[model samples]
Target: MTVYATFDSPLGELLLVGEESATAVGGTALVSLSLPGQKGAAEVRDGWRLAPEEFEEITAQLRAYFAGELTCFSIEFARGAGTDFQRRVWRAVEEIPYGRTATYGQIAERVGSAGAGVRAVGTAIGRNPLLVVRPCHRVIGADGALRGYAGGLPSKERLLGLEGALVP
Candidate 1:
Protein backbone atom coordinates (compact mmCIF):
# COMPACT_ATOMS: atom_id res chain seq x y z
CA MET A 1 0.00 0.00 0.00
CA THR A 2 1.10 3.61 -0.63
CA VAL A 3 1.08 6.51 1.78
CA TYR A 4 1.62 10.20 1.21
CA ALA A 5 2.25 13.34 3.18
CA THR A 6 2.52 17.10 2.75
CA PHE A 7 5.31 19.21 4.11
CA ASP A 8 6.23 22.90 3.99
CA SER A 9 9.63 23.97 2.78
CA PRO A 10 11.44 27.06 1.59
CA LEU A 11 10.37 26.20 -1.93
CA GLY A 12 6.77 25.98 -0.75
CA GLU A 13 4.50 23.00 -0.28
CA LEU A 14 5.73 19.53 -1.22
CA LEU A 15 3.90 16.26 -1.64
CA LEU A 16 5.70 13.02 -0.87
CA VAL A 17 4.27 9.72 -2.06
CA GLY A 18 5.66 6.36 -1.12
CA GLU A 19 4.89 2.95 0.31
CA GLU A 20 6.02 1.18 3.42
CA SER A 21 8.96 -1.06 2.81
CA ALA A 22 8.98 -4.63 4.01
CA THR A 23 12.70 -5.20 3.51
CA ALA A 24 14.06 -1.85 4.71
CA VAL A 25 13.14 -2.22 8.35
CA GLY A 26 10.89 0.69 9.31
CA GLY A 27 11.45 2.60 6.14
CA THR A 28 9.39 3.88 3.20
CA ALA A 29 10.67 4.40 -0.30
CA LEU A 30 9.59 7.68 -1.84
CA VAL A 31 7.80 7.34 -5.15
CA SER A 32 7.46 11.00 -6.10
CA LEU A 33 8.14 14.54 -4.91
CA SER A 34 5.78 17.07 -6.42
CA LEU A 35 6.20 20.82 -5.98
CA PRO A 36 3.71 23.36 -4.68
CA GLY A 37 1.42 23.58 -7.68
CA GLN A 38 2.12 20.23 -9.25
CA LYS A 39 -0.16 17.24 -9.39
CA GLY A 40 -0.25 14.35 -6.84
CA ALA A 41 -2.65 16.47 -4.83
CA ALA A 42 -3.28 15.67 -1.16
CA GLU A 43 -6.05 13.12 -1.08
CA VAL A 44 -6.63 9.75 0.57
CA ARG A 45 -6.45 7.13 -2.09
CA ASP A 46 -7.91 3.64 -1.79
CA GLY A 47 -4.63 2.04 -0.79
CA TRP A 48 -2.94 5.27 0.33
CA ARG A 49 -2.96 6.96 3.69
CA LEU A 50 -2.12 10.50 4.75
CA ALA A 51 0.67 9.74 7.17
CA PRO A 52 2.91 12.68 7.96
CA GLU A 53 4.53 11.09 10.96
CA GLU A 54 5.78 8.23 8.84
CA PHE A 55 7.78 10.76 6.82
CA GLU A 56 9.52 12.53 9.68
CA GLU A 57 12.97 11.60 8.47
CA ILE A 58 12.30 12.89 5.00
CA THR A 59 10.83 16.13 6.32
CA ALA A 60 13.81 16.65 8.61
CA GLN A 61 16.23 16.08 5.78
CA LEU A 62 14.35 18.50 3.57
CA ARG A 63 14.32 21.10 6.34
CA ALA A 64 18.07 20.73 6.73
CA TYR A 65 18.50 21.00 2.98
CA PHE A 66 16.57 24.26 2.87
CA ALA A 67 18.67 25.55 5.76
CA GLY A 68 21.87 24.66 3.84
CA GLU A 69 23.02 22.03 6.28
CA LEU A 70 22.27 18.99 4.17
CA THR A 71 23.89 18.28 0.84
CA CYS A 72 22.72 14.74 0.16
CA PHE A 73 19.33 13.10 0.45
CA SER A 74 19.54 9.63 1.97
CA ILE A 75 15.91 8.65 1.89
CA GLU A 76 15.35 5.65 -0.35
CA PHE A 77 13.26 6.48 -3.41
CA ALA A 78 11.19 3.98 -5.31
CA ARG A 79 11.29 4.10 -9.06
CA GLY A 80 8.67 6.34 -10.65
CA ALA A 81 7.25 6.37 -14.16
CA GLY A 82 9.77 6.87 -16.95
CA THR A 83 11.38 5.18 -19.89
CA ASP A 84 14.83 3.60 -19.72
CA PHE A 85 16.44 6.61 -21.43
CA GLN A 86 14.65 8.98 -19.12
CA ARG A 87 15.76 7.01 -16.10
CA ARG A 88 19.33 7.25 -17.34
CA VAL A 89 18.91 11.01 -17.69
CA TRP A 90 17.49 11.25 -14.20
CA ARG A 91 20.48 9.37 -12.81
CA ALA A 92 22.76 11.80 -14.59
CA VAL A 93 20.86 14.71 -13.09
CA GLU A 94 21.29 13.20 -9.63
CA GLU A 95 25.05 13.33 -10.10
CA ILE A 96 24.97 17.12 -10.43
CA PRO A 97 26.39 18.35 -7.15
CA TYR A 98 24.72 20.74 -4.82
CA GLY A 99 25.23 24.42 -5.75
CA ARG A 100 26.33 23.50 -9.26
CA THR A 101 24.67 23.38 -12.67
CA ALA A 102 24.90 21.34 -15.83
CA THR A 103 23.69 21.95 -19.36
CA TYR A 104 21.27 19.77 -21.28
CA GLY A 105 24.05 18.92 -23.69
CA GLN A 106 26.24 17.80 -20.83
CA ILE A 107 23.55 15.58 -19.42
CA ALA A 108 22.93 14.04 -22.82
CA GLU A 109 26.60 13.25 -23.19
CA ARG A 110 26.73 11.85 -19.68
CA VAL A 111 23.93 9.50 -20.62
CA GLY A 112 25.92 8.40 -23.69
CA SER A 113 23.72 9.96 -26.33
CA ALA A 114 24.63 11.82 -29.54
CA GLY A 115 24.84 15.61 -29.89
CA ALA A 116 21.22 15.80 -31.01
CA GLY A 117 20.18 14.22 -27.74
CA VAL A 118 20.12 17.50 -25.84
CA ARG A 119 16.45 18.03 -26.54
CA ALA A 120 15.70 14.48 -25.56
CA VAL A 121 17.52 14.96 -22.28
CA GLY A 122 15.51 18.09 -21.61
CA THR A 123 12.29 16.22 -22.28
CA ALA A 124 13.27 13.50 -19.88
CA ILE A 125 14.15 16.11 -17.31
CA GLY A 126 10.81 17.80 -17.85
CA ARG A 127 9.12 14.54 -16.91
CA ASN A 128 11.12 13.88 -13.76
CA PRO A 129 8.72 13.06 -10.93
CA LEU A 130 11.06 13.67 -7.99
CA LEU A 131 11.68 17.38 -8.59
CA VAL A 132 14.19 18.95 -6.13
CA VAL A 133 15.32 15.66 -4.67
CA ARG A 134 16.52 14.65 -8.13
CA PRO A 135 18.01 18.12 -8.65
CA CYS A 136 16.46 18.80 -12.07
CA HIS A 137 16.64 22.51 -11.32
CA ARG A 138 20.42 22.25 -11.55
CA VAL A 139 20.13 21.71 -15.29
CA ILE A 140 20.42 25.05 -17.06
CA GLY A 141 20.54 26.34 -20.59
CA ALA A 142 23.75 25.89 -22.59
CA ASP A 143 24.31 29.64 -22.38
CA GLY A 144 24.14 29.65 -18.57
CA ALA A 145 20.57 30.91 -18.36
CA LEU A 146 17.90 29.31 -16.21
CA ARG A 147 15.44 27.19 -18.16
CA GLY A 148 12.22 25.31 -17.68
CA TYR A 149 11.40 23.59 -14.42
CA ALA A 150 8.35 21.62 -13.36
CA GLY A 151 7.85 24.22 -10.68
CA GLY A 152 8.31 27.19 -13.05
CA LEU A 153 11.39 29.21 -13.97
CA PRO A 154 10.99 31.56 -11.03
CA SER A 155 10.98 28.64 -8.65
CA LYS A 156 13.97 27.22 -10.46
CA GLU A 157 15.91 30.44 -10.03
CA ARG A 158 14.87 30.66 -6.42
CA LEU A 159 16.11 27.13 -5.74
CA LEU A 160 19.46 27.74 -7.41
CA GLY A 161 19.83 30.96 -5.44
CA LEU A 162 19.07 29.15 -2.21
CA GLU A 163 21.73 26.60 -3.09
CA GLY A 164 24.24 29.41 -3.74
CA ALA A 165 24.52 28.49 -7.42
CA LEU A 166 22.98 31.85 -8.30
CA VAL A 167 23.23 35.09 -6.41
CA PRO A 168 20.02 36.14 -4.74
Candidate 2:
Protein backbone atom coordinates (compact mmCIF):
# COMPACT_ATOMS: atom_id res chain seq x y z
CA MET A 1 0.00 0.00 0.00
CA THR A 2 1.07 3.59 -0.57
CA VAL A 3 1.73 5.69 2.51
CA TYR A 4 1.55 9.47 2.62
CA ALA A 5 2.55 12.57 4.53
CA THR A 6 1.27 16.10 4.33
CA PHE A 7 3.23 19.26 4.93
CA ASP A 8 2.90 23.00 4.50
CA SER A 9 4.77 24.61 1.60
CA PRO A 10 5.22 28.01 0.06
CA LEU A 11 2.62 27.03 -2.50
CA GLY A 12 0.23 25.87 0.25
CA GLU A 13 -0.30 22.44 1.79
CA LEU A 14 1.44 19.49 0.13
CA LEU A 15 1.10 15.74 -0.01
CA LEU A 16 4.21 13.59 0.05
CA VAL A 17 3.40 10.04 -1.04
CA GLY A 18 5.87 7.22 -0.75
CA GLU A 19 6.50 3.52 -1.03
CA GLU A 20 8.95 1.35 0.96
CA SER A 21 12.26 2.50 -0.47
CA ALA A 22 12.13 6.23 -1.02
CA THR A 23 9.96 9.30 -1.42
CA ALA A 24 8.26 8.78 -4.76
CA VAL A 25 5.78 11.63 -4.93
CA GLY A 26 5.51 15.29 -3.92
CA GLY A 27 2.47 17.40 -4.76
CA THR A 28 2.01 20.92 -3.42
CA ALA A 29 -0.99 23.21 -3.18
CA LEU A 30 -3.28 20.25 -3.41
CA VAL A 31 -6.46 22.15 -2.64
CA SER A 32 -7.24 22.80 -6.29
CA LEU A 33 -6.13 19.39 -7.46
CA SER A 34 -9.25 17.78 -6.03
CA LEU A 35 -10.45 15.30 -8.62
CA PRO A 36 -13.60 16.12 -10.40
CA GLY A 37 -16.55 13.79 -9.56
CA GLN A 38 -14.68 12.52 -6.52
CA LYS A 39 -16.44 11.75 -3.28
CA GLY A 40 -15.24 14.82 -1.39
CA ALA A 41 -12.66 17.60 -1.20
CA ALA A 42 -9.03 16.88 -0.36
CA GLU A 43 -7.72 18.32 2.85
CA VAL A 44 -4.21 18.58 4.35
CA ARG A 45 -3.06 19.39 7.84
CA ASP A 46 0.27 20.62 9.21
CA GLY A 47 3.25 18.44 10.15
CA TRP A 48 1.97 15.17 8.75
CA ARG A 49 4.10 12.07 9.12
CA LEU A 50 6.37 10.55 6.49
CA ALA A 51 9.04 7.88 6.32
CA PRO A 52 12.24 9.16 7.88
CA GLU A 53 14.26 8.96 4.70
CA GLU A 54 11.55 10.42 2.54
CA PHE A 55 10.91 13.29 4.91
CA GLU A 56 14.61 13.96 5.06
CA GLU A 57 15.54 13.64 1.41
CA ILE A 58 12.63 15.21 -0.46
CA THR A 59 12.12 18.07 1.98
CA ALA A 60 15.77 19.01 1.73
CA GLN A 61 15.65 19.11 -2.06
CA LEU A 62 12.40 21.04 -1.96
CA ARG A 63 13.94 23.58 0.37
CA ALA A 64 16.96 23.97 -1.84
CA TYR A 65 14.76 24.35 -4.89
CA PHE A 66 12.80 27.11 -3.19
CA ALA A 67 16.01 28.88 -2.16
CA GLY A 68 17.18 29.00 -5.80
CA GLU A 69 20.52 27.35 -5.04
CA LEU A 70 19.59 24.03 -6.60
CA THR A 71 18.64 23.50 -10.20
CA CYS A 72 18.44 19.78 -10.77
CA PHE A 73 17.28 17.24 -8.24
CA SER A 74 18.41 13.66 -7.76
CA ILE A 75 15.81 11.65 -5.92
CA GLU A 76 15.18 7.94 -5.69
CA PHE A 77 11.74 7.33 -7.11
CA ALA A 78 9.69 4.71 -8.84
CA ARG A 79 8.15 5.92 -12.08
CA GLY A 80 5.76 3.04 -11.61
CA ALA A 81 4.05 1.90 -14.80
CA GLY A 82 2.91 3.86 -17.79
CA THR A 83 2.38 3.46 -21.49
CA ASP A 84 5.49 3.78 -23.64
CA PHE A 85 4.21 7.06 -25.03
CA GLN A 86 3.66 8.48 -21.54
CA ARG A 87 7.16 7.44 -20.59
CA ARG A 88 8.50 9.21 -23.64
CA VAL A 89 6.65 12.38 -22.73
CA TRP A 90 7.88 12.21 -19.14
CA ARG A 91 11.44 11.69 -20.33
CA ALA A 92 11.15 14.85 -22.37
CA VAL A 93 9.74 16.72 -19.38
CA GLU A 94 12.79 15.62 -17.42
CA GLU A 95 15.00 17.20 -20.06
CA ILE A 96 13.53 20.67 -19.44
CA PRO A 97 15.90 22.79 -17.38
CA TYR A 98 15.60 25.20 -14.43
CA GLY A 99 15.47 28.53 -16.21
CA ARG A 100 14.46 27.37 -19.65
CA THR A 101 11.15 26.41 -21.26
CA ALA A 102 9.82 24.20 -24.06
CA THR A 103 6.65 24.23 -26.05
CA TYR A 104 4.37 21.24 -26.47
CA GLY A 105 5.22 21.01 -30.17
CA GLN A 106 8.90 20.97 -29.34
CA ILE A 107 8.38 18.20 -26.80
CA ALA A 108 6.45 16.24 -29.43
CA GLU A 109 9.40 16.59 -31.79
CA ARG A 110 11.83 15.50 -29.12
CA VAL A 111 9.82 12.34 -28.44
CA GLY A 112 9.79 11.50 -32.20
CA SER A 113 6.53 9.64 -32.65
CA ALA A 114 4.63 10.79 -35.71
CA GLY A 115 1.19 12.29 -35.14
CA ALA A 116 1.49 12.01 -31.37
CA GLY A 117 0.67 15.73 -31.26
CA VAL A 118 0.81 18.38 -28.54
CA ARG A 119 -2.47 17.30 -26.98
CA ALA A 120 -1.14 13.83 -26.27
CA VAL A 121 1.98 15.28 -24.73
CA GLY A 122 -0.15 17.60 -22.64
CA THR A 123 -2.09 14.63 -21.36
CA ALA A 124 1.12 12.96 -20.29
CA ILE A 125 2.25 16.14 -18.57
CA GLY A 126 -1.02 16.35 -16.68
CA ARG A 127 -0.53 12.84 -15.35
CA ASN A 128 2.89 13.63 -13.89
CA PRO A 129 2.47 13.10 -10.16
CA LEU A 130 5.91 14.35 -9.20
CA LEU A 131 5.00 18.04 -9.68
CA VAL A 132 7.70 20.64 -8.76
CA VAL A 133 10.41 18.01 -8.53
CA ARG A 134 9.91 17.24 -12.22
CA PRO A 135 9.65 20.95 -13.14
CA CYS A 136 6.78 20.67 -15.59
CA HIS A 137 6.31 24.43 -15.13
CA ARG A 138 9.12 24.86 -17.62
CA VAL A 139 6.79 23.93 -20.42
CA ILE A 140 5.08 26.88 -22.07
CA GLY A 141 2.95 27.94 -25.00
CA ALA A 142 4.40 28.22 -28.51
CA ASP A 143 4.61 32.01 -28.47
CA GLY A 144 6.40 32.05 -25.11
CA ALA A 145 3.16 32.59 -23.29
CA LEU A 146 2.57 31.01 -19.94
CA ARG A 147 0.24 28.10 -20.55
CA GLY A 148 -1.67 25.60 -18.47
CA TYR A 149 0.25 24.24 -15.50
CA ALA A 150 -0.96 21.30 -13.48
CA GLY A 151 0.29 23.23 -10.48
CA GLY A 152 -1.42 26.41 -11.72
CA LEU A 153 0.02 29.52 -13.41
CA PRO A 154 0.72 31.56 -10.30
CA SER A 155 2.82 28.74 -8.96
CA LYS A 156 4.45 28.42 -12.35
CA GLU A 157 5.26 32.09 -12.38
CA ARG A 158 6.62 31.87 -8.88
CA LEU A 159 8.79 28.90 -9.82
CA LEU A 160 10.12 30.60 -12.93
CA GLY A 161 10.79 33.79 -11.03
CA LEU A 162 12.65 31.85 -8.41
CA GLU A 163 14.73 30.34 -11.20
CA GLY A 164 15.59 33.80 -12.61
CA ALA A 165 13.71 33.11 -15.81
CA LEU A 166 10.57 35.17 -15.36
CA VAL A 167 10.51 38.23 -17.64
CA PRO A 168 9.59 41.67 -16.44
Across 2-107, the per-residue lDDT of candidate 2 in tens digits comes to 4455556677766665555423334322112222121232343444444435456567777788877789987655555457888788889889888888888899
Please provide, for model 1 over 1-168, each residue's C-alpha lDDT reduced to its tens digit, 9 standing for 90 to 100.
788998888778798888888654247888888888754334446878888877888888889998889988887877656899999999999999999999999999999985999999999999888888899999999889887787888789888988899632
State, as a TM-score between 0 and 1, how close model 1 is to the true structure: 0.91
Query: Which residues of candidate 1, in runs, are more than 4 Å off?
Result: 39-46
Against the reference, the lDDT scores of all candidates come to: 0.84, 0.67
List TM-score per model, in order.
Answer: 0.91, 0.78
Candidate 2, poorest ten consecutive residues by summed lDDT? 29-38
Backbone collision count in every prediction?
A: 0, 0
